[model samples]
Target: MTLLRPQIDPQIFSALTPRDDFRAIARWVEPRSSVLDLGCGDGSLLALLGNELEVRGFGIEIDEKGVLACVQKGVNVIQQDLERGLRLFEDQSFDYAILSQTLQTIHRTTAILSETVRVARECIISFPNFGYWRHRLAVMQGYMPVSESLPYQWHNTPNVRVLTIHDFDAHAHAAGIQIIDRVILHKGRVIDWGQNWRGSLAVYRVKRYR
Candidate 1:
């Protein structure tokens, strides 16, 4: 899948990303907490979370274009290669660290997740769910699904790994990271998850024991 939808035109703001997602995310973030955003992309979520949550926010992004976008948003951005792992920050340096949408692209999800737990009291991670029915059908039919969330073509897709909701849960458990909260996003709306498998996206708040 193409990480950046070149033909879709760059959007300054997307009402497509619902406030419900932010509201869900806001619940886990206390006001005035130091927040670090990994693979922060264009800082849309960081800027929104920072402004609404009243928290100091830092963004780490590897893409040059994304770094520029973060700068434009006035988000505190550090342009660095994340695949190298997080060794520069001190332990417990922030209240929360966020890894959103970019987890699938990382070569080392375990390392990055561990780093987030080590650097902050809490962590939030969100990604496209590869096990959604549409994805299942597509794979069964021998074609990669191009849903709104997973909009990349398989040949040039940026996602190195595709994980399901259960897969993420298992990995988190193995890492000893507890799930503090979970939310599923679908068509930009937060849905009641008694039917959450129908949703296209999942967000999780995670933390370590100590």
Candidate 2:
């Protein structure tokens, strides 16, 4: 698929341009496919996809402000918590399901993953890598790392868990989810070598093992 840079509205997004994770996620989605975005913040990714690929997209967000932002952007969105699972969507209702940069904060990881795959042919997920060198060094020093990807103090953070590239790969294997494609990123650039130790973020495209 040809990836086009998304034209972002400054009013809808804090950043004037699409983030690297968004671009990476967009690359995997085919044009005009149906998409369900879980934990979609401000509907930025949906809007981007709409503009670039003309995808039929719907967003699920819990925050009132985020729901309002999606409306303002003319994107279809619903206000709902992801922990409850995707009961509203039927089997394979969408071509793709996207959970970008929000997996760590969820309490029911396995349930959500199952629901995501059940409701779509494939799912794309992105999250901060807990095994990056900086995070490891901080843990070694007896502190949680604070960086652009993870910018919260331990007490105030919403993250319920942390995992690495290997951690996720193992989890996917155990859960019978097939990881079809993966990309490791640091500072918006793809890392081709030493991904577990060097990359700060990870993205995966997956589907049911069967």
Using lDDT as the measure, the top candidate is: 2
Q: Write the per-residue lDDT of candidate 1 for residues 5-34, one digit (tens) a residue.
A: 122223444432533355667778898889
Indicate the residue-level lDDT of 28 in model 2.
96
Clash count list over all predictions: 4, 0
RMSD of 1: 5.7
- Candidate 1 lDDT (Cα, 0 to 1): 0.78
**How does each model score on lDDT?**
0.78, 0.87
Query: TM-scores, in order shown?
Result: 0.86, 0.91
Residue pairs in steric clash, candidate 2?
A: none
Q: What would the per-residue lDDT of candidate 2 be over residues 13-51, giving only the tens digit for each residue?
A: 444378779989999999999999999888889988988
Residue-level error in angstroms, candidate 2, position 76: 0.6
